[model samples]
Target: MDNIKLFSEPIADATPVIELFDVGMHYDSGEEILSDVNISINKGEFYFLTGASGAGKTTLLKLLYLAHPPSRGHIKLFKHDLHYKDRDAMAKVRRKIGVVFQDYKLIETMSVLDNVALSLRILGRSEKYIEKNVPSLLHWVGLGNHMHNKPATLSGGQKQRVAIARAIVNKPDVLIADEPTGNVDPRMAQRLLHLFKELNKYGTTVIVASHNTELVNTFAFPRLHLEDGKLIKYNAGSIWTLFDKKGDVNV
Candidate 1:
């Protein structure tokens, strides 16, 4: 707790885009998934969420993306406290956060272009604007040739690319990706990361949940590691703790 104060004290001028304080979660079976997790992610920062297969990574993501409420404690996104009962308010805040699920969650009936264009469409953009920008974004993700193809016709990696393109098209205030690179080759994975990097440069906070150590090590972003239902923030590429009293917070 002292270290949380230390880490937060130096950055008083900058507000956290996402804040979790003494948060905890559980399911119907009465099993606790996370406990007392405290974290604050500032604007424009990129963090890699790393842990084992069932280490509550996805569960934590569900909370961050505003899909579920914590069983205890508090969560604030974009400075608004999460009151899960307020569906309208939750939906409004959700629109400002883009999420790429582990399952891709694409509509099998829709074409690649249509899927990627859905976000812009929901925002009520004109057809002309959608037509002009969607193709260019698809091409950037190397899906130019598959714009008209449906999700059922594409491979796993291709579907993942489509999901990435869609999540980022609206340029939301924050982007959350769950195992975003799981289906792609190393080359394509790096390319996708570069895209996320470009978006972060433009002021979008990014959090990528992954178990891929090689890929995580390739970037110098600070990491939030989940272990035994607790959270620890660490400096990039080091064992030095960011939220422990003995180590300094460099992120």
Candidate 2:
């Protein structure tokens, strides 16, 4: 792990790595999903995206991950305006982001090692590099003994770990996880959060989306709370204070 950077090192005092200004998204029917969303997430910060089901948590993540363009407004990734970046330009930035889908998105046909190694393979990493690092990463995620197993054979928690291993294997600058702990027990959930915390300490900007309020409350990270198509960005204590007053702040 020391030889390989598990995440990119942040530049000192640079602009926010992610920025959204007057962003909005809607379906073909034109009902807005996100409205007037504006926020800036700096490099190496950890944030939790929280909201009720269908409160646009996933939608917001899609925008961050460059899954789709917003129906309107501007987005900047690493200081490149998404609206203007061509396909290749956008892809160049996208590679720096690692996403852990809620569904685990593993290839059942592939062994756990290969599943985790696919990103490296795609990036043209040498087989030797893959062999050396992939197994080591799997071990870090507590999957050392199961590297040869396929996805179908893993327990829910194990599969989640595989997904996480795959996401971080390429050392993405930004790591986005949607309900990463949703399938695991309380103990495992805490363990998984600790892993994310460790990644943040190594300079990866991490954004985790979760509805598990109890788990979220235990952490002191700032939060981006979405409600009724708007965003409320607040720190730990600010959320409780805002909840009591039934108020919201953009920043």
Candidate 3:
């Protein structure tokens, strides 16, 4: 823990965008999914959540986007404590965080353009505004020609791109991606990462949960490593490294 402190001192004058203290989650079956997790992710930073299947990566992500409340401990996002159960306050916070799921949770019945514009539409933006922005965002994600196509008609990569376009169309302050490159080719995966990097450069905090070691290593982002539902390692600087329980490092 001291070593973690040594490497994780916050940047001067920068406030953390997300903070978790002794966070834990468990199920009705009394099975612990996460325990004693502590982390702070500052604005504009990028991190890879690397762990095996069932290591609670998705659960932890759910906590970030406010999909679920932790069974214990505290979580603060954008400087607001999640302990406050005010619906209006929570909704306001959620409006600033965009999430991209692994399944590309687009509406199968809606056209790609409609799906991408859903957020703005819900916000009561005018059709004129939606019309102007959706296509441009689609074009940026390489889906310009496919805007009218339904999710059922798009390829895996195309669907992922659509998901990304939808998530960022409103220009949220934080973007959370779960296994974003899971179904794409390596080249497309890198392209997707490049997109995230570009967004990060524009000041969006990005957190990607993935098990793809090659991509994780290649990107050289700081990492939060989970094991058996516990955050065992947090490296905020230097190249990413995976360490086993025996303390053997894999670079």
Candidate 4:
């Protein structure tokens, strides 16, 4: 791995990358999954969404990625109000966000290279570009040797890496990951975090939902804590200096 800067200079003119105003989500069964949620994440900010199982961490991420519309209240992405229903507009907005789902969601029938290259392909990138970058990205994620294998043939950790590669290949402006390190080993989890941190340095706002408390404590980034379908705690600060002093992480 290369020695990439873990943190970039803070943006003095911080722009809201994601904003939620009294956002709420409820199911058809009248069960509320999220309630009165209000939060704002700025460009280049990295946050960990920590909560217990069924605490609505995934629900919140779904709202940001435009997967689930808020049952009530407002959501603003890149400063645009998200109150109206506009398929074309939503599709355009979604193109700028990358998501790594907990299920990995890899195509079992496709080779690892093709699976990781799907994002670039959907963006109409040329085959030449995919060929040039996908392999290198796979190598970076420790999946280079398995590029020709199908997802079903890979281990849980390998599939997770492939999903990560696919989500980030196009360099989306915002990245949302749900339990991205759940299946990987501790070392690999650190590596994945480093990748996300590197991307953050390049101006990508990242939100990672995880149940790994130990991993969360390793970084000093602000945390979004939810309980009983509501955001109960939020801390804002830099964890870079602390991490530099405490860990010998490469890149």
Q: Please report, in order, the local distance difference test score of every candidate based on alpha carbons.
A: 0.82, 0.85, 0.83, 0.80
Task: Judging by lDDT, tell me the better candidate of 3 and 4.
Answer: 3
Of candidates 2 and 1, the better by lDDT: 2
Which candidate number would show the highest TM-score if scored against the true structure?
2
Cα-lDDT of candidate 2: 0.85
Model 2, position 113: C-alpha lDDT score? 98
Model 1 residue runs over 4 Å out of place are 1-13, 240-251
Q: What are the per-residue Cα lDDT tens digits for candidate 3 across 129-190? A: 89887887787778889999999998889999999988888788889999999999999899
TM-score of each: 0.87, 0.91, 0.87, 0.86
Show model 2 residue runs off by greater than 4 Å: 1-14, 83-85, 240-251
Model 4 local distance difference test score: 0.80
lDDT of 2 at 80: 83
* Model 2 Cα lDDT, one tens digit per residue, 73-188: 88888888875448888889889899999999999999999999998999899999998889888888889999999999999889999999999998888999999999999998
Candidate 2 is scored at a TM of 0.91
lDDT of 3: 0.83
Candidate 1 lDDT tens digits, 1-251: 01111011112236688988878888799898887787878888899998898899999999999877899989999899988898889988998898988789999899999999988888899999899888877877778899999999998788988998898787678899999888788887887788787667667789999899899899999888877676767677579453543221233
Give the clash total for candidate 1.
0
Better of 2 and 3 by TM-score: 2
